[model samples]
Target: MKWYGASQRRGTLSRLAPDGKDVKAVTLYTHTFFLIEDGRSDEQKQPHYTAVGATPEEAEAMAFAVYQRAMDCNHAMQQKGPMLIECSHCGIQRRVLLPPAPPVAVTRKAERRFFNLF
Candidate 1:
């Protein structure tokens, strides 16, 4: 997907490690996934983050995994959708819309503030 910032750009499917070692034909299989490596490591060899999938189906399942991982990695992460898919070949991007979160319960004390207006 077309993310708005440079950092987001780095998180695209194109930047993900291929399912295999073949550099020429890198296909994102079901197991092919990406992860946001922990950035706290002092050694450069330690991955800042990582994502993986075991099968094509797993890859699809991991879409949400990655999104959650990103959110967990950065609480400020604001994505338009809960899941996103990008085709490395044609550069097509699609997003999977998650069901809206349940409305929060308002406490009686908070409700009283609005009642005064009524």
Candidate 2:
């Protein structure tokens, strides 16, 4: 009835079901993702990055790693430039493209403003 995290790196929490089988619940924010064209055209892509990941620190590190790899692939491709990066799930390893990094939410302190007509 309850689940606990298996580890920090893994994004899963598991528990036993009524039938004595393992029920693995995929934890949010633990999947790795990057920006790529969604087949819209040759030069334009969807205006968003796919999201997934690990811990805050780990996720940032992973995203940066993908960026680095993409840069390498870009050099190899030459004129084709960049736009594809390797995916962990996909088997074809010629590689794919990745952009710099995913956008992060900005947190700021709220400021209360009042009319000060003196």
Instruction: List TM-score per model, in order.
Output: 0.21, 0.28
Weakest ten-residue segment in model 1 by summed lDDT? 3-12
| Stretches > 4 Å off in candidate 2 | 1-20, 30-52, 75-118
Residue 79 displacement in candidate 2 (angstroms): 17
Supply candidate 2's per-residue lDDT for 56.
Answer: 54
Candidate 1's residue-wise lDDT over 63-109, tens digit each? 54555444434333234345644433322233445679999998775
Candidate with maximal TM-score: 2
lDDT of every model, 2 decimals:
0.38, 0.37
lDDT of 2 by residue, 14-115 (tens): 334354465554444442333344433322322112224545555545544544454334322222236533334321123345757988999998776677
Model 2 TM-score is: 0.28
